[model samples]
Target: MNATTDLLRVDAVKKSYGPIQVLHGVSMSVARGEVFAIIGPNGAGKTTMFKVMTGEVASNGGTIHFDGRDVTRMPAYERVRQGFGRTFQVARVFRDFTVLDNVIVAVEARRRHTGEAVGSWRNCAPSADIRDEAMSLLADVKLDALADGAARFLSHGDKKRLEFVIALAGRPSILMLDEPTAGMSPSDRSDIAKLVSRTRKERGITVVMTEHDMDVVFGLADRIMVMNYGEVVSTGTVDEVRNDPKVREVYLGKEMVSA
Candidate 1:
C-alpha cells in the first residue's frame, strides 16, 4: 500500500533512555482494515514502538501519523480519542469490579473528556443505556453470562476476552494488541485469534498486533513485519516474508523457517 493511503505510518522513529538507545530509525506502515503483525525477539523494541505510537513514551526523533494527522506529540488519551485503542501485554481490568462494570468503565472513559476519565466506575455507575450497551459489548465477546461476576475471579483467557470487549466498547478504529496470546493455551489462542478476526470483519478496524506465536501471526496478518535489534528486517505478505532470507536468518531462525 502507498504511504499516503496508510492508516498508520511510523517514520524514522527513534527512542533513547539515558545513554542507551532502543529504537533505531524504525519505520512501518499499516493499511486500513489490515492485520499487521510485528515479531521479534524480546527487547527488540516492539514494546517501545507501541509506547511511542500510543503516546505513552516520547520518541527522540522521527514522526508518527495516524489517519493523515500528525500525532507524534499527542497524549495517550488523545490517541484514544482519535479512535486508537490498545490492549497491554498483560490484561488490565478492575480487580474489584464485575465483568459488566469493567466494560462500563471503558465505555465511560471512552465517552468522557480526557482528564475526567480516571478511577473506577463505582463512583459513576453506567446509566441504563450504557449498561445495555456494555452488555451488548460483552455479548459480542461471548462474555455476557459472566457480566455480574468479579473480574478477579476470571481466568487469564477470560480476562483477555474482557480486554477485547472493553476495547470494543471504546469503538477504536485501529486496535493495538501487544502479545495478544502471550500465555494462552492453543484453544485460547485460537479463540482470541478468531475474536481479532471478527473484530476486523465486523467493525472494519485495522489491527496492529505483536505476537510471538508464528501460527497466529502468519495465520492472521495481512502483512508481517520482522524486527531485529530495533530495526525492521522484513515487511511483506506471509509468503514473501517466509521466503525472505533476511527474515529467515534474523527473525524466523532455521527451526521456524524449516517448520
Candidate 2:
C-alpha cells in the first residue's frame, strides 16, 4: 500500500512496564478500509500494542499517526473522538441498561459536545432522531426485537454482538477489536467474523484486530502482521503469512517447527 494513502501508521513503537520491556521498536501501517490482523502467541505483546494504540497505556517511546496527523500523545477518549473505536477482549456494555439504552448512550456520546458525556437516561429521553438511529443500529445486529430487554440478560454471544454494534454506534473510521471471538463457540465465532466483514464492506471502515483463532484471522484479515517477544516478525497477505516459516514458527512458529 502507498504510504501517502495509509490511514494509520505506527513507527518504532516501544513500551516498557517498569524494568520489563513489552514492545520493542514495533512498526506497521494500516491502510484505509482494510481488515488488518495482528497475530501471535500469548505474551507476544499484541494486547499491549492494542492498548498503546488505544492510549490505555502509555508508550515509553515511538509515534502513532492517524490520517496524516500525529496522535502519539493523544488521550484515549481523544483518540475515540478522532474516530478510532475500540472494543476490549471481554465485551463490555451497560449491564443495568436496556439493549436500546446501551446503544443510545454510545450514539449520544458520538454526537455530543466534546468533553461532555450523556450520563443518565433519567434526565431526558433521546429525541426521535436518536432513537431512530439507535434502533437502526440494533437492527443491524439483529437485536431489534430485544431492544427493550436488559443487557445483562442477553447470552454471551448476544453480548458480544451488542459490543460489535456499540463499536459502530459512533460510525468510526477505524475499528479496533482485541480477541473478538475468544471464548465463543464455533458458530458464534463465525457470526462475529461475518459481522466484521459486513461492517468493513458496508461502511468501508478500516479494521484492526488481534485474534487468537487462526480460522478467524485467516478468514477475516486482508493482511496479517505477526509478532513475537514484543517485536514484529512478519507481515503479508493471508497466503504469504500462512506460508512464512518465521510466522509459522513464532505464531504456529515454535509448535510447527517442533512438530
Candidate 3:
C-alpha cells in the first residue's frame, strides 16, 4: 500500500520485562479502513502487542508510525490525540458516575485535547453542546435510555457497550479493540460484532482487534495475523490463514478448514 493508504506500520517491535521477553521483533502494517485481526492461544503476547502499539507500555525496540508520523515514543494520551482509541480486555468505565457522565467526560477530554475551552468538571456541568454530543454517541450504541443510571449497575454486556461509546467519543481514526466480545453470551457477542461492522462501515474507521472467538474473527477480519510464542506465524486473508498448515497446527485445528 502507498503511504497515504497505510495508516499504521509497526516495524520489528520488541518488548521485554527484565530478563523475560514477551515480543520478539513483531512487525505488521494496517491499511486504512480495514478490519485486521491478531489471533492466537493464551500467552501468545497478543495483549502485550496491543499495549505496546497503544503506548500503555513502552517498546524496548523498533518504531511505530501512524498517519505518516513516527509515534513510537508518544505517550498514551498523546497517541489518543493522534487518533488511536482503544478498549481493554475488561470494560473500563467510570463505575460511580452515571452512564451519561461517562461519555461526557470523554467528549470533554477530546475537546480539551484539541485546544477547545472546556469547563472543568468540578466547576460546571457539561455544556449543552457537549451533552448533546455525548448523548448522540450513546444513542449510537443504544445506551441512550440508560443515560442517567449508575454505570456500576449495568450488566457486563451493557458495560462493554458503554465502553465502546466512550471510545467513540474520542473520534478515533483507528480503533484497537482487545477482545471486544470477551465475556458475552452468544447473542451479545453477535450484537457487538454487528455494532463493530456497522460502525466501521458508517464512519470508515480502521479497526485492529484481537479476539479468540473464531466466528467473530472470521466474520470481521479482512486480513488475519496469527501469532504464536510472541511472533507471527501467518498473515493473510481469511481463507489463506484458515488453510495455512502452520496456523492449523499451532492454533486452528484441522476441523476449522471444513467449517
Query: Which numbered prediction scores highest in TM-score against the true structure?
Result: 3
- The C-alpha local distance difference test score for the whole of candidate 2 amounts to 0.89
Clashing pairs in 1: none
Off by over 4 Å in 2: 1-4, 114-123, 253-259
Relative to the true structure, how large is the alpha-carbon lDDT of every model? 0.89, 0.89, 0.94
- How do the residues 1-259 of candidate 3 rate in per-residue lDDT, one tens digit apiece? 3568899999999999999899999999999999999999999999999999999999999999999989999999999999999998899999999999999999999998898867666767788889999999989888899999999999999999999889889999999999999999999999999999999999999999999999999999999999998999999999999999999999999887679
Positional deviation of 241 in candidate 1, in angstroms? 0.9
Cα RMSD for candidates in order: 3.2, 3.1, 1.5
The local distance difference test score of model 3 is 0.94
Extract clashing residue pairs from model 2: 248-253, 249-253, 249-254, 250-253
Instruction: Summarize candidate 1's per-residue lDDT along 113-232 as a digit string, tens digits.
Output: 545434455756557777888999999888999999999999999999998888888888999999999899999999999999988998899999999999999889999998888888
Candidate 2 lDDT over 19-42, as tens digits, reads: 999999999999999999999998
Once model 1 is optimally superposed onto the true structure by TM-score, how far is the C-alpha of residue 45 displaced, in angstroms?
A: 0.9
Worst 10 residues of 3 by lDDT: 116-125
